[model samples]
Target: MKMQAEVIREGELEKRSDSLFQLWKKKLVVLTKDSLSLFPDGHKRAKGKELGFGSILKVDCVERTGKYIYFTIVTKDRKEIDFRCPDQSCWNASITMALIDFQNKRAIQDFKSRQEMEQAAGKR
Candidate 1:
């Protein structure tokens, strides 16, 4: 089934192995404001995996060697998903920017909610 998400950037990238011995696979990658999705092919029938920003602790540019730029997506629970894209593709940078924006928006919303709750408590 197709995922229902507001698309930020969608394209193809290589998901690399997290192990010391690396392997790469081409996949269709989807970046939303709040999550990243990867599908085996550019078709709806392909099985997909989703990683939400809420669980993502950080995105790191691990290394750039030769024509590939390696990166890692670390989750709050300490899980790391590694990926690599062509140096010219800039997929890593775009994903990082979108994730940072999402986090900033969330922080502002959370701060506003806390302030409103405190004001209500003071009034009571």
Candidate 2:
């Protein structure tokens, strides 16, 4: 669900549809590159799928109490989630990831924008 603007040379503009001129297309250039860094280097793409992440969609974290943190993750199909974990390490990563996901969700206009991705992807 990303887009780009590419100019056509000569008189090719008239041959193509207006949508082709500049439209938001689901291009894998960003996904594949991201997949490479998120997953292992030799990781292979899942078969028969537009996205390798076939199940889980997003992750969220919430501070429940003084010593408790909650994780709320939604699936690709809008599934409900209410998970609570007392583990500090897990909760820390969860909170960090959620914060990063929010800050870098779509603030950048460019796909190569690695602002939020790095903070979340780091080995903390």
Candidate 3:
């Protein structure tokens, strides 16, 4: 059964577009335990792109200006997606904490699976 992801934080964040202009577009972002969803229309019902935490390597704070805190999300494939939020929003910190939590849970699950495999082999 597929489990529903819990919402950790939801807010409006500015994402640097990959287009030639490299303009920053406002995205309605929904931060979940397992993924970050970007809604283009700033509505929950709108179709959005989901970036799973499993594929994300880390979030790096790139720059900090007086108005906004810029950060980059590096994916496993080495793709860097830039984002920014208001200085007080703490979006970077929120994503980092959630990502760490997801990674720790995955590590625990992997360790349990290895133990179970070893136990089965011993029984045989």
- Note each model's CA RMSD in angstroms: 2.4, 19.8, 1.4
The lDDT of each candidate is 0.86, 0.37, 0.94
Candidate 2 per-residue lDDT, tens place, 1-124, comes to 6643221111100011125353322211113311201112223252312222334566655556655555554556876344454445354353344334444644453444575567678956
Off by over 4 Å in 2: 1-53, 91-124
Give the C-alpha miss distance for residue 20 in model 3, angstroms: 0.7
Expressed as tens digits, the lDDT of each residue in 3-43 for candidate 3 is: 87789999999999999999999999999989999999899
Ranking by lDDT: 3, 1, 2
**Among all windows of ten consecutive residues in candidate 3, which has the lowest summed lDDT?**
2-11
| Candidate 1: residue 23 lDDT (0-100) | 76
Give model 2's TM-score versus the native structure: 0.31
Off by over 4 Å in 3: 1-3
Candidate 2, RMSD to the unseen true structure? 19.8
The TM-score values for the models, in the order shown, are: 0.88, 0.31, 0.94
* TM-score computed on alpha carbons, candidate 1: 0.88
Error of 2 at 1 (Å): 35
Locate the minimum summed-lDDT window of 10 residues in model 2.
Answer: 7-16
> Candidate 3, overall lDDT?
0.94
Clashing residue pairs found in predicted model 2: none
